[model samples]
Target chain A: MRIVLHIWRQKNGRSSGKMVRYELPDINSHMSFLEMLDVLNERLIEKGEDPVAFDHDCREGICGMCGFVINGTAHGPVRGTTVCQLHMRHFQDGEELYLEPWRAKAFPVIKDLMVDRGAFDRIIAAGGYVSVSTGSAPDGNAIPIPKDNAELSMDAAACIACGACVAACPNASAALFTAAKISHLALLPQGEPERHQRSLRMVAQANTEGFGACSNVGECEAVCPKKITLENIARMFRDYIGASWTRRPAGASRG
Target chain B: MASTFQRTLRFYEATIGKKALIAVTGAILVLYVVGHMIGNLQIYLGREALNAYAHKLHDLGPLLWLVRGFLLLAVVVHIVASIQLWLMNRAARPSRYVRQSWVKATFASRTMIVTGPILAAFIVYHVLHLTVGRFHPGFNHELDVYHNVVAGFRNVPTSVAYIVAMALLGYHVSHGAWSMFQSAGLHHPRYMPIVQKAAVALAIALFVGNISIPISILAGFIR
Candidate 1:
């Protein structure tokens, strides 16, 4: 089948991006989307043209590095699946596919379909960890986390820091991504000391990083490859609001 | 509580500013409307009960003026924010990527923006007719609250406007209420649907309750 692709092309972060069109023929319907891109790149190289650049590491969908908006939906037409896991058969033989890098103020387009998602890393750096000293590994059973609680924590911790939530959101909110970390840690004993403080800090950082506030459109959950629930967003809000209303002594703003 | 500076940025002109303004103002309006409805329920407790309650509110002296000021600010913010949002949406994406399917949706949900201002106009007329007694020629300000409301509703135009405005207001409140829960991030999987239903039910209740006042007056039950 022949497919017309309108892929986003950018020389660099400083350059303006636009959709560049290309036609690929004889594509295998069984091949994964990334594989079709591979064939396109091979053809580009043979023709002495610069191949399209896109983010992908594992192609198996666990890496969380691969994602782009296809026809305005993040990670293509499928729900709860990454672009790497998307297949060519989702398109028609002569249909045109509009592909662009995930649009968010934080996720700046680096080149082609790749974006600089380092802002997600910085938000994590702000408060997304439990304090542990360098070398000695503690036993997991030491914390005595209940089975249900541990599983719930893991479910939230499954977020791979992909900006798909922000991409899918109407406001480009990173609340889903930030909430995932805040709830995952705040639920467990390991995160006890910083639970209240963590939600406040991460939420502030998310705003500082130029992400939009949550509009509760539920688009984030709809496109999340990990299928993270919007409930975590509520928990994060509850924590943030609770911390804000704690009523510290006067002149405490300086502290 | 992000920061004074951040809040200012969220207040001034920007995408965030407009949305924040809308949410803050909308929340205030909805809360007050619900409270107003609840307070008006005192009408069923007899005339003195309702009139005394109104007196207590008016007894706030200059503080009543302050409350009115805040409500005015809310109105300005809410209207400006909505206009900005509507314009931004128009500029950002002119056409839906998916086929537009708001057909099955109710007029109330689809027409919140239009109906909201109409409701606001109705509210202003309501205040003028019953509270100040300035707009209604037959209304006697010297007569206490109950007679003014009854006399105002006797006019055909006023009665029709009351019904139309309440209907639009109901539509705005229904969508706006549930949307607030989502905006505040209270929209969980299990709780979201319940919240939506409750918002709609509350809106309908207010619609029916408020409409009954004019209808009763028109039907000659409350002269």
Candidate 2:
């Protein structure tokens, strides 16, 4: 199968990028999208040309390290599948594929199809974790969490911080990512102590990162490789609103 | 330690806070629209019944103004929050997608900005045309509400504009009615499907009900 790729290319973060075309006439249908890209890169290297740059740590898709917009979709056209797992068989012969990085103020393009998603790290740092004292790992059974809560928590925990939600969102909002983080913790007893503050701080951090507001658009859920739902976003909204009403000023009287 | 007022100010600064304001104000506006549509429906009950209903409303006097004042506040907040969030949303993506395509967003969901301003402009024209008689072709200042409505819809262009605006409102409400829940964090899996269904029904009902008047008038059924 022959595949024509119009891949965005850039020297660095500061340089302007453009779509550069690459034709691969001997492509195999069974090869993963990334594998095909590798073949193209090998050919480019043999010809002494610069290879297309992209991010990929684990081809298994669990690492959440690899992604770029494949023809406008965050993780290509296949739902719930990352670019690393997308097979060439899913596409037709001689298909033209347009690849570009996630376009968001919070996720600036680094080189070619790679973008800096450091804003997600800053959001996580704000309040994505429970403040447990450093010690041995606690027994999971001791928490006595409800079965539904545990399942919901795990569902929200599936987010990989891939920036796909922001990439796919019309407003480039990080609400889905921040919401998943907030919901993942807010559902359990271990996270109860700092739930309100967690929502407040993380949401504030996401805002500071210049992510847009969530308008109930389900584009994020549709393109998310992890299948994260909009329910997490709703949960974030619920928790944030609760925090606004109950949160107190720092050093305020406890009484 | 931040002051309580300062905390409140900070809360309003976040996108969620602004969205919550939009949701609350949107709810108020939705209620007003439903009530107004029901009131307008009285026109079909004949001139006396409709005119008497208008008289009864005006009879509230100070109480009416109070409601009006509250609705005005809702409108102001809804508009302000919408503009602020819209600007922030635009700035969030400085670079546009080269070939982006929406997957799950409905037409109504994507066109809120377009529908919203058109509705706002329609509201202004509506108020001036009927309430103050500024744009009414044959507005009666004698508190003859029935005559005013009939006269207003008598103009073919005015009736067409009214129909178009109602269609836009339908589109706006279709997304907004259910979307307000998500914004308010009131969305629950158990109730969301119901809310979405109700939103569609409400949007269609409002469009049909509101436009029925103009269409009927143009057809010489209400003259």
Candidate 3:
């Protein structure tokens, strides 16, 4: 099958970018999207041209390492599938696709289709951790948790931190990503001690990172590989509001 | 010790806090518009009833001023929060996509800013034309709201503007009503569909109720 690609090319963060077109005449429908890109890169290297740059590891979708906008939708057109797991079979012959990096002030471009998602790391570092006593593994049923709460917590924990939510949001808001992290902890009993502070600090960190506030457009939920719901966002809001009005944390007071 | 006012200031500093303010003020405004539309629908009762309703409102005296004052505050805060967030949202994305397509976002959801400012402007003009009688050439100095409304809608351009503004208001409220619940963390999966449908229904009711006056007057049914 033949495919036409219009991919954004940027040498570095400070450099300007533009769409560069290439045609792949020999492409297999069975290959994953990233594998097809590898074939294109091989041809580019054979022709003595600079190969396209993108981040990927563990070609499985679980890594959350590979993604880029394809024809306007993040992680390609397949719902709940990462670009690394998105097979070429989804596309028709003689199709034209546009690929671009995640465009957000928080996620700067490192190279062609490669963005620095260090902002996500910084947000996680802010308060995505729970404090626990270091000891041997406890019994699984030691902590009495409601079944519904456990399931909901696991749902929120399914977030892979891929930055697709940020990429897909019209305002470039990281609300979904931040909300997922906050909701994951807010639900479990182990995450109780610092629940309020977690919401406060993590949200503050996200704000300082210059992400847009969520207007609840919900583009993020639609493109999320984990199928995280907007319910997580609502939970984040509940936590944040409760924290802001009730608790006078020392760190937040400094602001 | 930080004062309560200081704590409130600190709360308003975050984006969520600002959004909360927007939601609260938006709720006040939404309630006011709904009540205002219901009151206006009394024009079908003829001149004396509508004029008496206007007189009774004016007779509220200080209470009327108090309500007006609170509404003014709501409007100011709502616009300020919206503008600040709008600027931040724009700054968050310095460069837009070369080719973008909408997936789940509705036209009403995407064009809030556009519809918002126009609605604000329409509010000012609407007040001048109807309330203050400043823009009305057939101004009646007395509390003859029925005459004022009929005379106002008699002008072709004025009626057209009112129709257009009502349509935009419907679009704005359809997105905003549902959005307020989300912003306030008041949404639940079970009740969300009801909230969404209610928003649309309110928008439609406001549009039809408000615009029906102009249409009735222009069609010689209200005269």
Candidate 4:
């Protein structure tokens, strides 16, 4: 099946970019979107052109690295599938496939389709950790976490940081990302010591990093590859307000 | 703004969806409006008092800039988010407006996103046309911003625009106030309707207060 391709091309980050058209006469219905791109790139390379650059790793959709907006919707029209997992069979023959990188001031295009997502990392670093003693891994059963809480923790722990939630969000908020991290720890035993501080710090960091504030749009979870819920955001909000009120001035820096 | 390379590699750089940005920015603007109103009440003290109060607020300088900048950022984010969501929503299921019998919802709820940025854009022009003295075809700095505002509203078309926009503003804010709480995850079933009603009342109050400036000016009451 021949499909018309409108793919973004740029020399580098500083260079002006434009959509370059390509025509593939024979496309496998069974080929994943990435695989189709691969075939195109192979053709481009053989013909002495730069291969289309995009972000992808662990093409199985578990890793959040690979995704570009397909025909406008992030990861395409099918809900909750990564670009790598999207198959050509879902599309019809000769459909004009318009592809572009995620568009946001906070997310600048790196090359053709890749975006800088370090803001997510900074948000996580601000308070996504439980300050555990760096010695040995704790035995799984040692912490007497409540069964319900333990389950909830795993649920929040499901965030893959793909920025799908951001893509899906009307605000591009990392609410789901931050919520997953905050909730993962918020539901745990070791996390209690710094739960409030974590929420306040994470929320502040999230704002400072330029992610849109969470408005509980629920689109994040709806299109989330991991299906992270907006409820985690609620939990984080509770922790933030709770932490702000309960927290006392620090006596000294961490030893 | 950082370079494109910096954005890609930085990893954390992410935008909130345009709709959510609009919602949150609208949330912040509501706050600013509330604060503005409380301060504007100093107007009843007469021009000397109001000007003095305004001068004092201006003296806050960088702090004021910081707050204003954040608010502006929120507004930008909100507008962008609204457009993105509206586009996506339109694409997901194209909606068309038609006059027909249907189950009715609040006017504010339906048009909040549509009317919101228009109001914000008007506010920008309002400030510019009156305060900055740049947007007006007839600029006279000798005519104070207050005077420009007064005369501007006296125009029939301008006054009508304010009234229509203010009605939409009321509708948007009414739904918005309740939504912010919901976004924060306040879900007690029994309290939802009550909360929504309170939001509606607050919306009405805000709309009335804001519209008063234009309406009063047109009525020859604020001269």
Candidate 5:
């Protein structure tokens, strides 16, 4: 199948980018989106032209390193699949595709389709963790968690931080990502000690990073490759509001 | 004073804080609208009941001013916070999408930015026309509340504007009420559908109740 591609190209973060057109005369329907791109790069390399630079690792789609907007939808027209796993068969022959990097203030474009998602790392580092002493692994049966709670925690934990939520959101809000992390930890007993502080710090960190506020648009949940629900955002709001009123000052009253 | 000022600044700095402010102010406005609707519905009870209700409100003297002052503050805060949030959102995405699609957003949710400012403008016109007797030539400033309402709605242009504004207000409130629950951290999966339905119901009720007044006058039913 032949496809016409309009891809955004840039030399660096400071450079202004534009959509450059390319035509692929031969594309296999079975090839993944990333594989198709790899074929394009190989042809570009043979002609002594600059190849498109996009981030990818573990093409199975678990690493969350691969993504770009394809024809306006994140991870392509297919739902609950990352770019790395998206197959070329889904698209029609002689299709014209538009490719662009995830556009957000926090995630600046590095080169071509690559973007700096270090803001996500900083947000996770803020509170997306459980504090435990260095020791042998705890016995699984010792802390008996309810079946429903365990499943709920796992559901929220499925977020891969692909930045699709931020890209798809009209406001470029990171509420879905931050809320998934907060809800995942806050749901478990092991994450109880610092749950309040976690919600408070993570949300504050997200705001500090210049992400927009969530207005319950639910676009994030729609574009998420992992199918993460918007309920996590609501949970995060519940936790943050609960913490803000009850969490004490550093040297204030104990109660 | 400086510390208090800093604390207030810090409160508005967080995105969640700004959302909470919008939700609270939205709730205040919703309550006022519902109360106003019920009071105005007394117009069905004939001229005496409706005018007597207005007279009772006016007789409260300074209390009436206090309530109006609080409502004015709520409106100002709601508008300012909403505008700041919108601007921040715009700055976050400097580059617009060549193509865009909405997954779960409704027309009401997407049009809030447009409907909000229009509603604000309508409020000014409404207050000037009915409350202050400044805009409408038929407005009675001699404490004839019933005469003022009936005469104001008797104008064709004014009635049309009122109907249109009420429709926009309904759309605004429908989205606002549903989203306010999420913003205020009251979301529950089991109850969310019910809450959304209630929001839609409230919006429709307000639209019907408010528009009915002008419609009734235009039809000679309220005379």
Candidate 6:
């Protein structure tokens, strides 16, 4: 198969970027998108030209490190599959593909296709965890969780922090990513103690990171690799609103 | 005192806070639209009934002014917050997509940014034409309420503009009403579909009810 690629190339974060074209005449149908990129980089290296720099690790798609917009759809045209897992067979022969990095104020382009997603880490650090004492692992049977609750928590927990939701959203909102984290923790008994505080902190951190507001467009859910639902965003909103009202002012009277 | 003010400012600065403001203010405006439609529907009941209703509303004195003031505030807040959100959304994505695709968003949701400003402009024209009798030559201030409405809609261009504005209003309210729930953090999976359906119904009802007046006059049914 022949593929014409117009890849975004940049020297650094401050450098101006442009789409540079390359032609690959013998692409295998069975090769993954990242593997196809590997072939292109090898060819570029042999030609003494700079190779496109994109982030990837654990090509199995679980690490969430691999992503770049292919033809404007996050993780390619197929839904619920990461870029690393997207095979070349899905595309037609003699296809012209337009590749670009995830565009967002928070996610600045580092090199060619790589963008800084550290803002997600900061949001998670804000309160994406439950506080527990350092001790031996708790007995699984000791704290019995409802079956439905456990499944719901696991479902929300499937988010890979890939930044696809932010990438696909027209507003560049991180509501889906932040909400997945909030809902995952809030659904469990262990995460109940600091639920209000977590919601408030995480939401405030996300806003501070320069993300836009969610308008219920559902684009995030559509492009989500894990198929995370927009319901988590609603749940996060519910928690955030509740927290705002019940949260006490510093040094205010407890009575 | 300063700290309290700062706290309030910070609350509104957050995206969620701004969204909640839009939702609450949007709800107020929706209520006013629905009430206005019901009141205007009395035009079908003949001149005495509709004009008597209008006079009765005016007879409320300061209470009427209070309601009007609140509605004015709501409209201002809703528009300001929405514009700010639109600008922020644009700033977030400095680079536009070369090939964009829509998956879940409807035409109404996508066109809100366009329809919103148009509706705002239409409101200005509507007020000038009907309320102040400034835009339309046929507008008569001394005439009864029913007579003023019928005479205003009797003009071809004015009636067409009114009908077009009402259609845009229908599109705006359809998405706005559904989105207000999510904005207000009132979205639940089981009930969201119901909310969306109700939004569509309300939008259709408002469109039909409001457009009926101008259509009736143009068809000589209201006269």
Ranking by DockQ: 2, 3, 6, 5, 1, 4
For all predictions, the C-alpha RMSD in Å is 5.7, 1.2, 1.9, 11.2, 2.1, 1.9
The number of clashing residue pairs in each candidate reads: 0, 0, 0, 31, 0, 0
* DockQ preference between candidates 4 and 6, better one: 6
Cα lDDT, all candidates: 0.76, 0.91, 0.92, 0.70, 0.90, 0.90
Over the stretch A96-182, how does candidate 6's per-residue lDDT look in tens digits? 999989999989999999999999999999999998999999887898889988998999999999999999999999999999999
Model 1 earns a TM-score of 0.75
Q: Compose the digit string of candidate 2's lDDT tens values, residues B11-55.
A: 798899899999999999999999999999999999999999999
Docking class of 2: medium
Candidate 4, B1-223: lDDT as tens digits: 3454653333222222232334456778888877876675554456666667766767898998898789778777667656655553443222111111112224555566677777887778667766677645555575344555666777778778777877777777787887776654454546776987998898888787877777767777677
- In candidate 1, how many Å is residue A70 off? 1.6
Between candidates 3 and 5, the one scoring higher on lDDT is: 3
Query: What is the per-residue lDDT of model 3 for residues B110-147, given as tens digits with 9 covering 90 to 100?
Result: 99899999999999999899999988999897878899
lDDT, candidate 2, residue A61? 86
Which candidate comes out best when scored by DockQ? 2
lDDT of 5 by residue, B1-223 (tens): 2254665566677778788899999999999999999999999998899889988999999999999999999999999999999999988888877767776778898888899999999999888888899867777777788899998989999899999999999999998998898998888889998989999999999999999999999999989
DockQ of each: 0.21, 0.76, 0.68, 0.06, 0.58, 0.59
Cα lDDT tens digits for candidate 5, A1-255? 988899999899999999999999899999999999999999999999999999999999898999999988888888899999999999999999999999889889999999999999999999999989999988878998888889999998988999999999888899999998998888899999999999989998888787788988788888899998878898898888777666766666654
Candidate 6 chain B: 10-residue stretch with minimal lDDT: B1-10
Q: Candidate 3 docking category?
A: medium
Docking class of 5: medium
With candidate 1 superimposed using the best TM-score fit, by how many Å does residue A186's alpha carbon deviate from the native? 1.0
User: What's the CA error at residue A69 for candidate 2, in Å?
Assistant: 0.8
Model 4 spans > 4 angstroms off: A135-140, A252-255, B1-114, B117-177, B183-223
